[model samples]
Target: MSVSKLAQERLGDYILKYCLLFEINIFYFTFHTTELRSKHSTKYFLLCCFQTCFHALCRKFPPSVNYRKRFLTELIRRQETVDHAPLDELYDALADVVGAEEKSECYKSYLLPCGDTVSLLENVALISEGTTGLVTWEAALYLAEWALDHQQVFTGRTILELGSGVGFTGITICRSCSPKKFIFSDCHTTVLEKLRDNVQLNGLTEKMSPAVSVEELDWMTVTKEQIKEMEVNTVIAADVVYHPDIVESLVKLLSKILSGSAEGAPKILICSTIRNSETYSGFKQQLEAAGISHHVITGPVRKVFPYNRDSFIEMITLYK
Candidate 1:
């Protein structure tokens, strides 16, 4: 392959991975000054990179205003160095990007496979209000995509989501799937507050069929009454199996719910991004010990959400 083609491919791959994940520092490193100076087709390469980056940011809903501003600022600087007259369209696009209100919290929109968009407001910080549930994790996106692919399983069923971080998966399911009722449960105060806002932000406030509800569920201290009251025919959770104690508490809660759930036998779907091998293995071991069986679901070929392909997300369904 030609050197110019190789460089263009490399830059495209880098931007798609880092920029989509909001990794601003990595984006700069990928497009470092030394590499740009060395390339002979500097103008073409820079323009391609700028156009590609701009399109990617826009495609990924709830575009990160801060990241877009930083990316455009650097692109403008580089364009000025290469050509005395930068593109007027670039400046206009930058102004529109600047119009995105800077705030501690922001919305992210995801275009579902069913032609529906899911938008959520997330904390700028990864960890906020003493919990790491303020933002949409890759596993949540993974599960949401999986649910979209198999809507038949959720149609007309009462679905309950545990650890509904910012309500991404739940809201997506609520909008895309025909669930009879949707319940979002979280233990943290701030997480629950934001989850409700996200549910409303999607204009899902009408108390029609598939009525949406939020509940404060402490897995460690949950009561039997709460489990019985859920009346959920299906339970789903994403990115909730990070810590060992959490795994045990979550397993206990699931066992209690499965043992006494009035919905006969509820389907349980858990999607987890395996950051730690031990944590994932521990979760499986606990499920085996509890006599619950799980099956891994295959992922779809088409992309529904903009997330890293190498995130190693896994989706599993549990049966009693």
Candidate 2:
């Protein structure tokens, strides 16, 4: 595909994934044609791209404020490089995405390198509905990047994700990693609802991709029987160590799940953002107390997603 086709594909994927009604109709215009000797077609195509992007910013489920703001700002900055004069729509779009009020519900879409995309409808507020689990964390992005880099870790393995927030990591893995099964587990009802929405949004439901399921898991009260029944051989958690109590609960639950695995003790991978030193240390202390051995992992040379490369994201490989 040509460069413009690739761009349209990516943008179309994002629009469909997020259900960006305001931005969905822009790609109908011809953007990848090379034989356009007439300036009319070229101008029309460019207008479609920029105008739809502006309309997207004015929509309810537009991209994140920071992303839209930066995109608009950069467009205004680089408009002079193009063959056409800048349109007033560019400044209006900048103001729309920048000055729009935050909505309670919005979408976040991630375009994968393999032309697949993972999108989510999430709460704009961090602590929405009395739970922080509604928002995707940095560690989840980091873990998804790591998983995409190391596909062998999940290939043909039944994977279970603990504390899957909005199903970003799970959906990404389902698309990129060749896993036998993927079970996404979380506790919050609101988060679970949105998680299932995201999973279905990515078309990973049983109807489309038979190997995915969303389950409600209470880490503190889960029984060994449930873990055994899952028949999972790999476990993963991302950004689950925010609270000390939660860390204790997670370690205890992980110890039980790992010890009771019928598939020869599943491989456990925990990815966390080291936001607070003491909280992370408490997590380590809990892991040690549970008699589970874990070590930091550091072998991925490249990342698969666009995220903060300099963030303090770390992965620990745990074993029984």
Candidate 3:
């Protein structure tokens, strides 16, 4: 049984589970391969495939991988179960699995540590925190990759990421972007803690990596004190504009973060892929009406051969 074969067998189910919330292509990337015992051919093949998926979505002169999304449009046919549970436990358990499974480090040793609930990587109902977190329908990794490709926006700047799922994008910047600092903010303290553990699992900390912080930031009710407490100068969010109802409140939070800054000015960079025309149109209008116009930059996302249906990010820059 080759590792690739083993991985492929599970990839379909994983894709289906992820597709329940996002486009299935979002979960089809290569899992971690940093310290695989597999041969170079297998390892390199996995890496190339991942790059292809990323590049295809980022619009980087298309690669050679031709993948599609509708293959799973009818695949993830499960209704999202909204069982009530503490979010911290969910984030901790899920983050442990994701961080350990991450190619960055700690795989094989961390297999969804807390065996209490549904996989945080898949289950949505278990995520508990201060204010409710609306489902943001997009891959957080692609957003991180897009932001990394544009290091100039984050280079030497204090950056903050809200609703950082598995802390992939913020962690990506800690590893790839030349930011002075990176803060991974989430509503659930459990997610924040797992994000912290992930940073460590990857051997990243103040001692070994760039400056990073994780905090509880319920966007809807964030106070002036909370905004002032953060030292961030730029904010980045991925696929966070899905729900039209929360756009105004979320933008207001970003506005508050930007409003209190003394240094030149703060920018809120939101990345999304057009999931639905109605949501995209309304979110854009909401941002503009609040005096925060949006800037769209097509990122060079993938290196693989991309199909028209590859997962990608929509880079949005906001300013008053």
Candidate 4:
């Protein structure tokens, strides 16, 4: 069978597993080619697809060395089944990755439905720099997917994202939802630094019209005056309700932000992975005690990014 046919069959697997490349419209290749140019036209055409995909993979948003090595190895293995001679570009790409120095940091790119990519520089380890915020979490992916569907909530509104981590949810909203301004906040110095890098990596700098800014926001000590200064219409946070102390502080912070808003209480959205039922319930209880009403948002139908789907992630909208 031809490479295009083979790729068509495995496209879904590639997207779900690796998420290294966007969906390539195979019809583009077939429709554009009127006639075979050479005896090796099929091989050449397949190589063109690889080159186009890998150009973005290598230059724009390269995955880790390990992922790249595995991808190239699989490609070469598939090629061997069809032809005896090896593709030089594939071999060279593999060699480069094999020889490249491995590092703690790597880039991950998520393909959006609008054909734009939200690329982030993430730490390979889940916990790095004495914090979990260096890497994007599953809850952030779930929140981002939800945001894409509810763009109207964000459009023309200023948003404040608490515990922004690596800025995945904020950047995705800035790119797609048309938010008027986005403020990414985290308490940790390391997390704030990486969050700034990710915001810049996605090209949502402060200079943009829908202004983007990163700030240090410690929920435990943040005052009502500080919340009032932000002038945000919406507040969001993801994966921050895991710890009891954090949940307490987060509830207090949300109370202050809601009560202090100049116009009115801003809309609040908190997405959390239900890692511990006790902790999740504690969060809800605190919200109720603070006179904040919240309800679980209906989960988005479209899953845009690859994440741990088995994790029970819930989105909650809050009002004061």
Q: Each prediction's Cα lDDT score?
A: 0.76, 0.73, 0.53, 0.78
Candidate 3 stretches with Cα past 4 Å from truth are 1-138, 301-312
What's the count of clashing pairs in each model shown?
2, 0, 16, 0
lDDT tens digits by residue: candidate 1, 1-320: 23466666666655554453343353443454355555353554455456444564445444567876776677677666766566676687779878878777765656565656676778888987789999989898788878778889899998889999899889888888889999999999999999888888787764866798888999999876777787889999999998887898888888887886765868888889999999999999999999888999897565666677788888888877
Runs in model 2 deviating more than 4 A are: 1-61, 64-70, 80-85, 89-101
Query: In model 2, what lDDT does residue 167 have?
Result: 89
Judge candidate 2 against the unseen true structure and give its global Cα lDDT, from 0 to 1. Answer: 0.73
Stretches > 4 Å off in candidate 1: 1-62, 74-84, 92-102
TM-score of 2: 0.78
Which pairs clash in model 4?
none
lDDT of 3 by residue, 129-231 (tens): 5323322234555565566467787888888888875665666666666688887778775566666666565556665447777777788888866776676
| lDDT (tens digit, per residue) of candidate 4 on 127-149 | 97778899888899899999998
Preferred candidate (lDDT higher): 2 or 4? 4
Q: What is the alpha-carbon RMSD of candidate 4 to the true structure?
A: 5.3
TM, every model: 0.77, 0.78, 0.57, 0.85
Best by TM-score: 4
